[model samples]
Target: MDQAAAGMQGAHRAPVCYRHPDRETGVRCTRCERPICPECMVSASVGFQCPACVRGGSDTGPAPAASRPRTIAGGTVTADPRLLTKVLIGVNLAVFLAQLAVGSSLTDRFELIGQAQFSLFSPVQGVAEGQYYRLLTAMFLHSPTNYTHILFNMLSLWWIGGPLEAALGRARYLALYFVSGLAGSALTYMVADPRLPSLGASGAIFGLFGATGVLMRRLNYDLRPLVALLVINLIITFTPGFNISWEAHIGGLVAGVAVGYAMVHAPRERRTVIQYGACAVVLAVVVVLTLVRTAQLT
Candidate 1:
């Protein structure tokens, strides 16, 4: 008799969702305790809630601005506060301002001049004699004659940098920047006209391009647009009007793609270790090339 009574009670107690009267549901809103269907439910910090209760709840807050993404120039940037990108831009801006403050002296010192100007620095030494810093600092210096130069580089940096920095973290991104820039300088050292002096962040920015391309390709994105952009930039670099360093662009792009590939494809367990190791190997190669170029010069 007791079991029969219990069964009868259970059978009569079945509840149907308020939103959909025909469908049975046991889930209740955490806040209102009202039965809700899956379509009517909203996930909250505490538990599932009815849409009405969620709308009325005082505890919920808006999505964080820090993680929000925005589009600027040709790249996507998040509010996630990438310190490396800010620092790079700030340093570049400071150097640009300082260039305006002084004049040709800064350029003469930091610019990656061709072998002719390099030979004048020291005839008896390898590595351009006392001017090795140019390999790194030249990325910061630009054509002080053209404001457009710094503007475009900075824009490109802001566009491509935030995502890479976020994905690679601060240290690796910094390493990527310098390695690509140095490789560009190395190539410039080898291929640039001995009479020409080149300076700009094109190589570093192009490094971002290559890295972004690698990341995108890893995620199975089409590489056609990237290739097109590369071709267009190459054309722009050698277009006969603007004094551009195709060597830096090419070198940086290749290095970026290489390093970026290594970074994205590393074993998940030792991702950072392998990525850093790859950078080390690439930088070692750049150093070796520099030494060889210096040997040829001397």
Candidate 2:
């Protein structure tokens, strides 16, 4: 017979209980291989056990032990609603609709309502002036004259933003979007015209593209489609009569790449410091360049 069977047979042969070796017990504890008298035994799911063993086992071990709570990254986790993308889209659409409500022709409306040279689009100039907010506000404003401006940007966001938002969570995604947008605007201000008003989410969208590229590379995902799409869009940006901000597009794209490299490609343990520092450095350089260009223009 097997050892377990032999043990059981020997246990049955003894009139004394298995647990209470000193006493002539008549019952066995089902789980722990112990004996008890009839007065100490209790019925359980599997068989009979000493009342004390059952109670103590339930408290001390797996018998009725508290379940282990599940963990994500070694802590209890909660789901995060994707709020940043929705808020960004809402703000852009709201601004577009507001532009429509104003009584201006399409190109003129976009120039005025979107963002343009302070003299052309607004009544102010210089960074210190209240018009300085235009550096940021412009990103939320799109060309009301062209449907493609909004369509392409929003589509890019849908495709690229969803995955990034899922990976980075809402806060980091939002920060990347705004910082990239500002980087794009700074590039345009330096290269194009600071006094000239320009506005669109294309810069931020380009940043998303950059981030997507990094994500693909790090995750070993297929990148051919993304590269193809980027090439096609850039071609469209440079096409004659497109009236697109190629400068902003390039700037945001570069910023996104830099940020993504720091965030997604860096070793996990070093990412937090490296990512924040890289983004900050990029923003500072853009700001300084914009300031110098603006000074020269004035």
Candidate 3:
């Protein structure tokens, strides 16, 4: 009877996870035999291990190459994948607010225009006059007069940017975005009327669209939905009354596809080099187009 009571007391005092002192757990690290909760468990050949054991060699050492978590584009896995996307949206919204407060004062300096003098006495202002930053700033600006311009673009960015950020990771995703936006800006400068101004997140969003298409293809997802959406957007872009910049759309889409393809398909051994090399190539195209347009305008 005394032995039975002792056994009962021992059972009540069952081990708790070392890492989570408050939680009781039957699981233990296979290597270290330390009690571990589910959250601390890492799959091992024989059984689960604690995170410390999974790190290999020592409790505080770096994980082995085989053990490190990686994203589809070889970026480190992060807790919050959509952080950068949210930041980009916030920046666009903030810029739009500035446009509202300041009007053409902000728009005139940032919107992509080849070259123009607003009035007879006004100083010549444009990329041709060395306001080259317009190519970048233009991607974040939207039509303050048209609410739907920012609305639709922001929605698209939220929807597409989140998943793409997760897949490509932050650095690669940023590279894809800037390169695609610049591609759009360059193409718009190359072909559109010099006196006309163009600005929007459409180019960057379209780049995300193309990248999303490539990612879907890589994952063997349903392509029909993406195709239908692309067709609809293309129709809207070319519609006579809309006055959308088709050059930006086409440029962003092409750049997105090219960069995204490299991001997802590059061999693991040479992934970083190949992925960034593709971005550099597209950026070169943007620079070339910009230079040619500037030469012509001047």
Candidate 3 deviant stretches above 4 angstroms: 1-66, 120-124
Q: Taking the tens digit of each residue's C-alpha lDDT, what string does model 1 give over 86-139?
A: 899999999999998998777777788645443454432223564677788889
Clash pairs detected, candidate 2: 19-34, 19-35, 115-197, 115-198, 116-196, 116-197, 117-195, 117-196, 117-197
Q: How does each model score on TM-score? A: 0.69, 0.67, 0.79
Model 2 bad stretches (over 4 Å): 1-81, 103-130
lDDT tens readout by residue for model 3, 1-298 = 9999999998888588786688666667778899865445554544556767656646565678787645567776556878999999999999999999997779888999899767865555999988999999999999989999999999989988987897688899999999999999999999999898999989888999999899778655568988998999999999999989999999999999999999878877788999999999999999999999999999
Cand. 1 TM to true fold: 0.69
Best by TM-score: 3
Per-residue CA lDDT of candidate 2, range 1-298, in tens? 6999999987776456453355454346777767554333444544455534655754233333332211111111114334567677778888788877774443333331222334555344444332455667778777777878888788778777865665555556776888888898888877874445677898999999998788667544568999999999899989999778898899999999888777654444555677677778888987797667656655
State residue 221's C-alpha deviation in candidate 2, in Å. Answer: 0.5
Ranking by TM-score: 3, 1, 2
How do these models rank on lDDT, best leading?
A: 3, 1, 2
Instruction: Give candidate 1 regions above 4 Å deviation.
Output: 1-79, 116-127, 222-225
Error of 3 at 170 (Å): 0.6
